[model samples]
Target: MSKLENIRIEGIFIKEEGRKATLKFDMPFYADSQPVKWADSGYNSISLEIDIFDIHYLEIKT
Candidate 1:
């Protein structure tokens, strides 16, 4: 088995009204970005809400 700390964000899901609705993406966030709210300590996936404008700017982490 792998260690808890070895686990990392592998995907992200965002739900927003009047927009794309449900979006599931494989990601790590970004090298220069900050970590957002996670679903667990050994977080490998996340669910959040995002605006239409910001959707194009999203990037995966290192």
Candidate 2:
């Protein structure tokens, strides 16, 4: 796997409400300007509520 593929996001699915869902992760998050790149800066464990509409697609791995 490439470096990007090796970047795993370990999180618990909180819930889905309307067109939004929340995730609670223990991993640090970085605000990347590019869609496929991790930025240099990052924040500690965080919970994020993201709009489903903003997502172009979803990928789930079993």
Candidate 3:
């Protein structure tokens, strides 16, 4: 059996690679006490890239 950890991410759907999907979101992001921030804000939004393999399942509402 595998241990499952919960992860929550809020972002906008961007695009996908071969095995990854990119998301657009806000910064001041943190995980496991680690933090990330952008020094500059040239673009209107931030992008987050996540692996599809990390996702067990998802629900889409449209």
List where candidate 2 sits over 4 angstroms from the true fold: 1-18, 28-57
The prediction achieving the highest TM-score against the true structure is: 2
Q: For each of the candidates, give the backbone clash count.
A: 3, 0, 0
Clash pairs detected, candidate 3 = none
Compared with the true structure, what per-residue lDDT tens digits does model 2 show for residues 1-62?
52333334455352343334444333244444433322333433334433344444456675
- lDDT of every predicted structure (CA atoms): 0.42, 0.41, 0.43
Model 1 scores a TM of 0.19
47 Cα displacement, candidate 1 (Å): 5.3
Better model by TM-score: candidate 1 vs candidate 3? 3
Runs with alpha carbons beyond 4 Å of true place in candidate 3: 1-20, 29-47, 60-62
**What alpha-carbon RMSD in Å does predicted model 1 have with respect to the real structure?**
11.4
Could you give the candidate ranking by lDDT, starting with the highest? 3, 1, 2
Q: Of models 2 and 3, which has the larger TM-score?
A: 2
Worst 10 residues of 2 by lDDT: 37-46
**lDDT per residue (tens digit) for residues 1-62 in model 3:** 95323323465452343334555334443344333343243333434544454454556543
Q: Could you give me the TM-score of model 3 versus the true structure?
A: 0.23
TM-scores, each model vs. reference: 0.19, 0.26, 0.23
Clashing pairs in 1: 28-61, 29-61, 30-61
